[model samples]
Target: LAKTTQPISMDSYEGQEVNITCSHNNIATNDYITWYQQFPSQGPRFIIQGYKTKVTNEVASLFIPADRKSSTLSLPRVSLSDTAVYYCLVGDLNRDDKIIFGKGTRLHILP
Candidate 1:
């Protein structure tokens, strides 16, 4: 598993775009960059995943560079309800690996 680093907290106003970046210095070739968003008293919800280049869904977009050492989760026109903790994980999702959850980046959407 590749260790990830992310900001402790971020703040943005409603209707503004929010980007959270994570760094995985020891990412492996088979590793995939996955992002999750979690609200209070709820499990982490899958946001996006990408191996390289860029991936976009209706919810958010994920960007991964060629080196795969870093990734960014971009949320367009965020709202107050989108406030949550965002987690960045790097690993092979095929096998049953013991996944560890760290203190993720807490995103605060202000009015």
Candidate 2:
């Protein structure tokens, strides 16, 4: 299964679009890729998820390759409030599992 990798940090001005990509080379068959956003001192909140192809919601768009080795989270018309840390979690839902957190990609939005 592919492990996940993401940028340590990113910066954007208000009203700009931000796209964060995560690479997972050995993702398992039963694993699902989920994206989350977090502010300082807070837990990550679910942003989006996908098994394959593309999935979009009011908050963001997720694009996954056919091989499922990587995924991207695209935030459009970003505002200062969008500045935060973004995380890509890869794991299976079945069985009792523990989710771990790493230093996520920090998105800084300039006012």
- Say which candidate scores most in lDDT: 1
lDDT of 1 by residue, 1-111 (tens): 688999999999999999899999998888888899999999999989899999999999998888888999999999999999999988886766656566899999999
Which stretches of candidate 1 lie above 4 Å from their native place? none
Model 1 lDDT-worst window of ten: 93-102
Give candidate 2's whole-model lDDT: 0.88
Q: Pick the candidate with the highest TM-score.
A: 1
lDDT of 2 by residue, 23-77 (tens): 8888888888899999888978999999999999999999999999999999999
TM-scores, one per candidate: 0.95, 0.92
